[model samples]
Target: MFDLEQYLDMFLDESKEHLENLNRNLLKLEEDHSIETVNEIFRIAHTLKGMSSTMGFEKIATLTHKMENVLDDIRAGKLKITTAIIDLLFEGLDILDEFVKNIEAEGKESDRSIDNIINNLCNLNDVETTDSEKDSSSQLQDDFQYVTSIAQKAKDQGINCYEINVKLEESCILKAARAFLVFKAVEQNGEIIYSNPSTEDIEDENFSDNFNIIALTKLKKEDFKEKILAISEIKDVTIKDFDKDSINLDQVKNLTVNTGNKIQQNNEQNIESKNDQSESKQRKGKTSKTVRVDIDRLDNLMNLVSELIIVKTRLEDIDTDLKGQNMNEAIEYLERITTSLHDAVTKVRMVPIERVFNRFPRMVRDLSKELNKEINLIMEGEETEVDRTVIDEIGDPLIHLLRNSIDHGIETPEVRKSLGKSEVGTTKLIAYPDGNNVVIEVCDDGSGLNIEKIKKKALEKNIITKEQAEIMDDKEAAKLIFAPGFSTADKISDISGRGVGLDVVKTKIEALGGTVEIESEKNKGSKFIIRLPLTLAIIQALLVTVEDEKYAIPLNNIKEITSISTDNIRIVEGKEIVLYRGKTLPLINLGNVLDVERKSENNSKEIIVVIVKKGDKDLGLIVDNLIGQQEIVIKSLGKYLSGLSFIAGATILGNGSVALIIDTNSLFQREWYS
Candidate 1:
């Protein structure tokens, strides 16, 4: 039985991505109207329709199907490209986006008022038809049919189908790449009706190198064909006719793996050798094997494994200290192997940055038009990877950032041309791996962040004191632009300025362990760069002890740990503050924050003052003592701590105790209460 609710959520996520892509690409297609771009738009629509149909979202599927028809018509050149068609497409996208929002709130497909949108799309059918409307079946296949057509003509010149037997050596890396090359070479001479693992998995790069099947047409083999011997990874390729009886049933029967351990000694080697032996038992008809699980399910699995890994590490450490040297060595080896295994498993939970970046161009296109501005969006290094958690939250913040760019960052085309700049303003979305973090940039070649306007607005809104405004630098003043209800627009525009707190974006990003930074020069444009961690499940954490309780502090926030004397812990406005390197550091006692009782009152007890940085501000975390660091897997705090913003999460220690990991920002955000 299929779970409708879970399937609906999956459909909703997939639909949002598809819709974003459609909206973005539609705008790009309007400007260029090239055949290739139109075909891409058609394909995206086709995919959305198919996905919606499978999920039983009838309204969305029906609407998208009509949209696909129009796109197909355009692709076939039956309908001439026009600004009207693009406008209708944008209208469709807006309706779809609204429907998606309803689903997100209601947890199912929405009962959207899509009647007008559907009628408008239906109106496109009245256009005069062109002769380019050939049968839809006469389209391109993934394989180049033209090349195959040329090769098929040689069949009369002593060419025939040959079944090639491929045997792969063990311990081969780059299996998918090697297999792809072999397939291309074999496919040149013949057609591949079947592969052992199936073609989809091969395309997704999801196979190991051990077996291959090729049905070749150019088989005049007195000797074994081709340069299969030249490929470094492939062991051998033997070619023969596609005979059912010719398969090595023994080799097919035995598929085994060995981690190569000596402790198993005779028994392990016996099992290995026995698996290698093939008997005359009837086969199971060579059924393909693979499990199709959703990416979210994989994330849940990783979370479980990460917790178990922490416990495993803690156990090994204890076993080493208490159980002598030899037992420690064996446990240490197991720890090494499993830790690497866990790292590889965690990599599976990451999504490519391209998933988030590919949906922007069309958005920039329409907004520019509606606002009567010209903007070109350039994307770079989109192959960057981030945890699925980060990817899920990243889309909207970038959307608001781009909209702010279009409506406010870029000026009107006439204004731009007058300023000696290109009439077309350019917006860029770039993502690249920076150390252990992913940096996403949304930049535009329009008006930069207006500092004076922002400062004036801040003072007028009472966001900052007059003295503070006067003393603050242009860079510092720009930060106020993200404040709640901070907009430089003279009047609220439909595209960008809403009364809602733009600071919510900053808050949300900070909640994800990400920091958003902005840079601008007068009349040049503004760039918003968001730095986010690659993964949230695992991080190098600084372990500290406060009143006999262990706490995990993310290493990213920790500037350094130092011993602060009682003299250094000075009083500023009756609040305990530490003077470090000629600056007053606001200090929060850990025990007080968690409501735990302190053990000692002596000022000489030697405090581990951890200097933590949240943006430009700094705070000192005063702990009873510092514990050594270890790799611990983070676990969620569950529903009990639903509103506990200060506690990011908890992690399991080796001895099976849970340590609460502090959310540095939330902790810093609270000082007076602490």
Candidate 2:
């Protein structure tokens, strides 16, 4: 028996891709009423209909079929594209999306009522609803005519057309698989142009034990029957010649009269098919290739690369004299190979950020209407790529930022015009690769962050003291918006204003080994910049020692390294601080924070400090000694030890010892610094 479970993942993946295409193209259609866009949408709808039907998702199939009819009418110029029509189509797309989500979550479509959207679509196209049996019977005459046309074409090409009937045994378990096998067998002899219950119905096992096929082949009747009966489950096979002359002349005339446009469409399709064949032949040697491997498999491949790096490190630590010059050369070569392998695996795990950016245009459009504001959203650098793991976690943070921009940053049309700005406020989302990081900036040309308002809210929420707010500069005031439980809005709504948005964005981004910063002016605009590492698995880190405990600090976060004398360190507000490069820098002692036991008191006068920058703030971490830098693989501290104060993860050292990596962002939190 065939295992349906094996195909579920593939089906869901493809269905989601199709849905995304439909949504993207529909948005395009709304803006530009071009025939190409309409036809593309029609094609997508038809394909989704067939796929859902074959998968036995009757609601999706039925709904898409209705959508297809409306698109067909629009293509035929029977109905004009309008806002109402577009909205109705969008409503239908939403339903289809929900259905797909339900299938993915529950292994079946949702039981929600689709009658409203279905009826709305029917009313739009003036299509009458009918029972399945009635619908199938009504299409029999059209199906017969279609088969006759194919048969006539085959006869002209000097090929014989035959109607073949095959019946399966009553005990047939996987009817769909058996039918597919039969089709494959028949295709080897000739082409099966038509089927009795339609190919989709047969694949869905919606038919009885018996089914018919119209085949165009050069083989004789007995030979075709013999080939089909060779299958294991076949109970009987019958074959008969299909004669076009047997079709009634009156019926042909009526079909031509009623479906003249459809016939023209069929002719156009034939030309397209011939063109496609020519193109296929011209490009036969080259094939586009892609494969969808489960994420777990990619993670395993990354683990292997990490192990190879560890082995390389081990070889490098070996005594060179005992192993000789050959060992040195071998180690060098292994290091080069491991580096290249690591890069290759990392590339494999990287995906274009466009997957996360595609959904925002629709979101911005809906929000524009909801807020009764004329807003234009511009996006760039969609081709920037990040690790697959980052891609999966980055969407929500970006959404929060975008929503925050729309609700709190961009002003209304009248307000914008009064401020001498464009009536239609503009919001821009731009992404680009910067060195080892991908930087995403969300900017708006509307009213910027209200510094005073933010400070007021911070004080009201007890997020900051009045003394701190009074001394805060404009930049520091803007940063206050990211404080937990901070909001400047007078009332809360669905968009934001529950004091839960920016903090979440900040937390999530920092958790992904990224950083978020804000730049804003009172009447100008606001730009939120987010910087994320390309990959999380392996990174170059500066190894350090606090007392006897070893730790790793990500190289990307390090701005500079310097030493300060004990006399230069000062205390302010009961926290240690130092003047560096004419600016005050807060200092955190790593040994004290981690509670590492001191081996002995040091008589050293200088202290080694690693300066790490989070956003616009800088802090110095006091460490015992620097072990230089090394490429390290980050391994998660298991669930039991997760959320360990400032430890991000652990890495295996060359000596097989483990060193915990510092979470620099966490150390920069207000509690640690302020």
The best candidate in terms of TM-score: 2
TM-scores of all candidate predictions against the true structure: 0.70, 0.83
**Distance from true location, Cα of 166 in model 2, Å:** 13
- Model 1 worst lDDT run, 10 consecutive residues: 254-263
lDDT of 2 at 177: 75
**Which lDDT tens digits does candidate 2 get at residues 1-674?**
65677788888898888888888998999899877788888879988887887778899999998898788667645578889888888888889999999999999999998888888888766643233235554555565666677668667766778877899999998888788889888876666665666565675588899887777677788888888888889999988888656445343322211122433343334322557546755676454457788999999999999999988887877776678888888988999999999999999999999999988988898888899988888999999999999999999988988888887788888888888888898889999999999999999986788777788888888888999988989988878778776788788788975235778888899999999888887778889899999999999999999877899999999999999998998988889999999999999888988889888876689999999998778999999999989999999999999978989999998889999999998887646596
Candidates in order: C-alpha RMSD to true structure: 14.7, 5.3
Candidate 2: segments with Cα more than 4 A from true spot = 127-288, 320-323, 497-500, 670-672
| Weakest ten-residue segment in model 2 by summed lDDT | 251-260
